[model samples]
Target: MSRYGPRPFFPGLAAALLAASVTAAPAVVTDPTAVTVALAAPVAAGMAPNCATPPALARSVSAVPWPQQRYAPERLHPLATGAGVTVAVVDSGVDRRHPQLAGRVLGGTDLLDPGGDGTRDCVGHGTGVASIIAAVPHDGSGLRGLAPAARILPVRVSEQQVVDGQGTGRTVAPDDFARAIRWAVDNNADVVNLSVVLYADHTAVRDAVGYALARDVVVVAAVGNLHGNGDPRPYPAAYEGVLGVGAIGADGVRADFSQVGSYVDLVAPGSDVLMAAPGQGHHRAEGTSYATPFVAATAALLREYHPELSAEEVAGRLKSTADPAPGNGYGAGVLNPYRAITETTGGAVARSAPVIALADDRPDPALVAQQNRRADARQRAVLLATVGGVVVVGIVLVALVVPRGARRRWRPADPN
Candidate 1:
């Protein structure tokens, strides 16, 4: 299939493809080409996946801590652990009964299936994302989130289906997604986390995000992971005034599959992240979907610590304090949550930057070129290494299959 081809209607295919290509290197293309190609794809919504599996219970062990290198929650816990802040996770439903999220999740609505409450999650995606934001550690079995003391408001915008005992996955209509964001804003959510990607930019969604911004609500979204195909500017993330987040691995570099663009406000740990799954267990997931909550949780802490800062100011602080890196894709840089919370603002006022209505948030030309060059070089190196390893393995296999005498005869000719 082409990079921007129509997504498979069968949710299983989408999920399987996502899992298989979690680490695939993205193809570098000019902004215009990427945007045009991505626009050709059908407008549908689905969860971005690094990798996922069925929720199953695992044995409890001693306090198994999250990788501090990825997210050092302990460092900031002393100052502010998102106290008095409410983060709205807009995605599939969350498992309220999950051990990690039991007391933290507040009442929310299910826009997808109005008959059911938003407390139960059919697929574990929402729960996993929520856990990354506010899962409370209990008895050392559960993992602690970036803002453990923060409250979670689970707003279910998508519905998951189970066919033949396997999760078929979920989808959210643009209207529903828009409604969910508006609802979160109306409910006084301090931060809104959108983990899903919509192929098209719907007016409703954009307006909803604007409304949230007007109310000083910090909106964080995952820049879509399309296996490096096409432009990664998926909605809500593509919308102006929203903090678009990308994924970086433990190496502190952008993930090969992470979408790169100017809209990427910041990046956080996304690969092999251990989070709470649906059935009271934990799972390691990857994708920009997982990266978003770290930023959202950080926003909660920022809002809690500096209630005086506006949403724009909080976003500016994050950008201003981010670690500088090579590309426009990395945005300001990787997130420094501690610096964002503790550093003095120096009395700088937040400025209203121009909000581009276009889908591709146009990045600086020089920076884009540089980022593309670096990405291309890295991908080439990885490709060469893979090829070399394969060739060596093939040679070994051939040698093993050949007789001893044949192997000796096949030795390289001696050149004097």
Candidate 2:
């Protein structure tokens, strides 16, 4: 598959991101060109070896990423920090050693390796996605997840890696993907984020999504990054209950590679998006896969703020509160985390007004009657006041005119 990397935020960072090579432990990317490996799926995890060779470590970046400045998730801390919410990351494994993710990740299930929890990341993709949703904030580092207090349940299902210019990694089969989702839901995950995308829709995957929805779990998936490659709809994004996400750049427009379709329910900052690497430091990447986490993170905030809300209600709240961005495949709009948590859904907050759909332009009969009553009362009061004022003026005029006429009654008034 032919894939392109996203442009860097600054001209100087461009060379570092698109570098020819990098060196690190067995779990990171080696060739910088292969960092976009998130888009390529070559082998199945079921057929591949249990162990994975790490690629190169991600490059260190100190500057605050654009997504952080745009979303300003910190403002939502007073309202909701995703407390008591569990978000399952159904992607590559998450590295528990990251300082930002410490104490926030749960001992999740790893379908690839049953002996260990889902904390080990081989491709570094899952680690980045996890950080975006729940990485804790630290000094000297502007990078932090949207819901820092939310617990992460890592469901390691893919060990995808890139060797040389081609794709060589172990990803889960369609059946395994379904099992992964079911495992997350069964493990009591409030929200499930699927950064992984499959081109074809599988019956097992569809059924799994339905199962999650039935269990009242908010499921989010990427719409895929194959806009240039025929723009095929990806599953389980196209699945009925999934919140399909697309990628947007700093300009708040759709990323060039993000797929477009009715399946897309929302868009998020994905182009040149910053993420925590498997071991240490941060790097920039882009794709609908990256965008999926933003919505998932917002779901976590909603779940925390409104524990009474169902999975579908949380999803609906997000869609209804998003900033309006019309057409060109920009879903409902950019994900607004602060509004998602603070906005009222006719619940305790008492914020968002009810949207009454009018079948016709005519006014409501009850409201019209109420307005008519108010108008009639006002008209009666005004008429009485007008009559009183006219009577007073007439009496004053008659008194003045009659006195003046009496003074001039004896003879004709002098013409002066």
* Best of the candidates, TM-score: 2
Report, for every candidate in turn, its global Cα lDDT versus the true structure.
0.66, 0.69
Off by over 4 Å in 1: 1-54, 58-67, 161-170, 326-328, 346-416
Instruction: Tell me the tens digit of each residue's lDDT in model 1 across 1-416.
Output: 10111111112222211111122333343442122111111111222232243334444334544444445777888988998899998866777777778788999988766765567665566777888888886775637888988999988765443333222444555666678887887776888988766555667777788777766678898886664566545666777788888877777778676787767878877776777766566666567878888889888998788766667788888877777765657887888888888887523334457443324355534334535755776799899999999999999987776777585776657896
User: Which runs in model 2 stand beyond 4 Å of their true positions?
Assistant: 1-52, 345-416
CA lDDT, candidate 1, residue 253: 79
lDDT of 2 at 36: 36
Give a tens-digit lDDT track for model 2, residues 1-416. Answer: 11222111011222212110111111232332224333222211111123445445454566788899988876988888889889999877788777778899899988767766888876667777888898888765678889999999998776654455443444556677788888897787889998766555567777788777766788898876656555666667777767888888899889777878977888998777777766666766666767888889889998877766767678888888888785679777888888888777522212233212213465444334535755776799899999999999999999888888888775676899
Error of 1 at 377 (Å): 52
| Candidate 2 clashing pairs, residues 3+ apart or interchain | 26-54, 27-54, 28-55, 28-56, 29-55, 29-56, 30-56
Error of 2 at 166 (Å): 1.5
